[model samples]
Target: MKRSYFSAPYAVWMVVFTIFPIVFVGLYAITTRRADGNDLYTGLANIGNIFGNEGTYMKVLWRSLSLALQCTAICLLLGYPCAYFLASKDFAKHKTLYVLILLPMWMNFLLRTYASMGLLERNGVINSIVTALGFKRLELIGTQGAVLYGMVYNYLPFMILPIHTVLKKMDQRVIEAAQDLGANPVRVFYKVTLPLSIPGIISGITMVFMPSVTTFAISGLLGSGNFMLIGDVIETQFMSANNWNFGSALSLFMTVLILISIGLLNRMDKSKTGNGGGKW
Candidate 1:
């Protein structure tokens, strides 16, 4: 029972920050404010505008999803291998490497993105090097690729760390048992290691994908305003357009969509665990 006391702060935090904000946003989503700043019940009129003849919000939504999916996929591909290498017994400095991976995250996120922008900017370090070597400077910023790069760089560590944690905590005896059963290295990995790591993979996907989907700062900095995602649009509505009702509605929609995604991922993880993955 004493152990339960440790959770009190977390519970308070959830109520104050998460639950209250969500409820407040939901209230605003279903209502419109009048000229005198009094809220009037609108019954989804703001949501209706999302699917109205303009259809611009739909495009922004698609763009956000597409880039987020791409970022998630890229992070998975890159992080799994890095995680595997770090988790391997063959790497004597795995713990040191893990610390290095976490080091950059200690810095402010906006500052890190600003650093990336510097690296990718025209006449920046990368271009300067290429020009010195007699190669033409590449257009790195103000493009979809730059936005994707920012997402991948910032979120890749989130993917790698979870997978590494699970891999490091995995049961070595299960792997040895697979090998004793005459399984090859690759076969043992596929049959034992990979299945056990499903939980971490799912966790990594959730962490990376969710942030990538709702990011505005990274896209704004890297894309140089050329790309406008749903997050950017929502920011515009609230901060610039002063349309709290529509912004709240969009936020609510994104929240629902993200919840659905988490649900689906959870179901998939459960199914995988039932099939072959051992609980860690």
Candidate 2:
């Protein structure tokens, strides 16, 4: 009874902070408002508008998914080696190196996005360097590549930390055994280290992918509002258009999409574990 009483506060807090907002948004999504500022109960009207309007929302969603996947792939490709080096080596000042990796995350996200803009613009340092080297000036800002670069830069730490954690926890004897059995370093990594680090890969992928899909600040700051990612769409609908119903509907759709993707990934992970005969 005492424990139950103690847990009540947390349960009430969850209801107030989490569940209530969801319920409120859902209710708002299904209501209609007149020009006179009176809201009327209009079931499914907002949802219909979202799907029936030439699928603009869906296109934005797909763009967000594509950007997120690209960012995750880049992070994995770049972070794997860095994480492996950090985890496998006994370098001087190793802790300092890890701290440096984490330092970017300590800064404000908006500031980081703006900083990326400063470095990628027409008169930016990158352009100046390219011109100095006698290469044509590249349009780094307001391009898909710029958006992707921002996403990767912002989320790389998330990818690295998870992979590093797994690598650090790995048993060194496993590698030694493979080497003792005449296995090359590459072969040993593929057969032993790579297989053992699936959890970290999964963790990193989820960590980077989820946030990248929902990010608006980077796209706004770096992409110069030219890229219409789903997060930006949601912001526009709610804040700019003042269409709470449509915004709520889009938000709900995005939330559902993310939940479904997470569910599918978890199922795939379970299937892989079952087939591989390995436990996470």
Candidate 3:
């Protein structure tokens, strides 16, 4: 079979779905719907409104970015240790552990987040335990903390799996060579294992950070709609506010931001390679 046969389907899919939607959004973003239901070309008007001095929507963008960075940092901190342990040769049950890590992710993302709501609700399991222990019932839901927890819980596996795969496939001989050279366990990990796992770390960071920025459902369910992320603002513009032009503008901005993030991360990965990240 010709390679064109395999490539044809993907090309069609991109044209119909990806390319078409972007073109549609771009048109809507650059035009304004007049009171007569006619869309007029407005040039940079919509884009300006988003980043203009009076554009308070910029705050929502910053908040989403801040939360995404925090979520990525937290996932890296928690996932690296777990990945390190799982990749250890002495961890005989690593396969079973891998399955456990993947089990929750198999469920619908919305359903998993909804289930978390039950745990964080006022009369929910966690608050019940607090009350039983004679402590005051903590306000678990409808807060920034709840939203952050949801982001971390939902995305942590993405961080772990990549790092685990990288660590597991790493050359054991390189690690042993470091040990033989009188490098302690900590030194070997810092200088060798960690550097070798940079690709996976970068993959995990991008994966978690991208979705975290655009997630509106988690904040809706967990934050009780109190937290307005850029995603939520875009959703409101398109759905409730009947402002397609502005919504499309926000969507375009975010798409550009995400693309820039991926480009920067790729550069970082290349720089790590160029600098011989794993060198002793």
**Candidate closest to the true structure, highest lDDT:** 3
Q: Which digits, one per residue and each the tens of the lDDT, describe model 2 over residues 119-194?
A: 9999998999999999999999999889999999999999999888888888889899999999998999999999
User: What lDDT does candidate 3 reach at residue 167?
Assistant: 85
Cα TM-score of candidate 2: 0.90
Off by over 4 Å in 1: 1-7, 275-280
- On residues 1-280, what C-alpha lDDT tens digit does candidate 1 reach at each position? 5699899999999999999999999999999989997999999898888887578889888999999999999999999999999999989998899899999899998999999999999888888999999998999988899999999989999999889888988878999999999999999989888889999999999999999999998889999998999899999999999998999999999999999999999999989886533222
Candidate 2: 10-residue stretch with minimal lDDT: 271-280
lDDT of each: 0.91, 0.87, 0.92
Residue-level lDDT of model 3, residues 96-131, one tens digit each, is 998999999899989988899999999998999999
The CA-based lDDT of model 2 is what?
Answer: 0.87
Candidates in descending TM-score order: 3, 1, 2
Model 2, runs deviating above 4 Å = 1-9, 274-280
Q: What is the TM-score of each candidate against the true structure?
A: 0.94, 0.90, 0.96
TM-score for candidate 3: 0.96
Measured with C-alpha atoms, the lDDT of residue 219 in candidate 1 is 84
RMSD of 3: 2.6
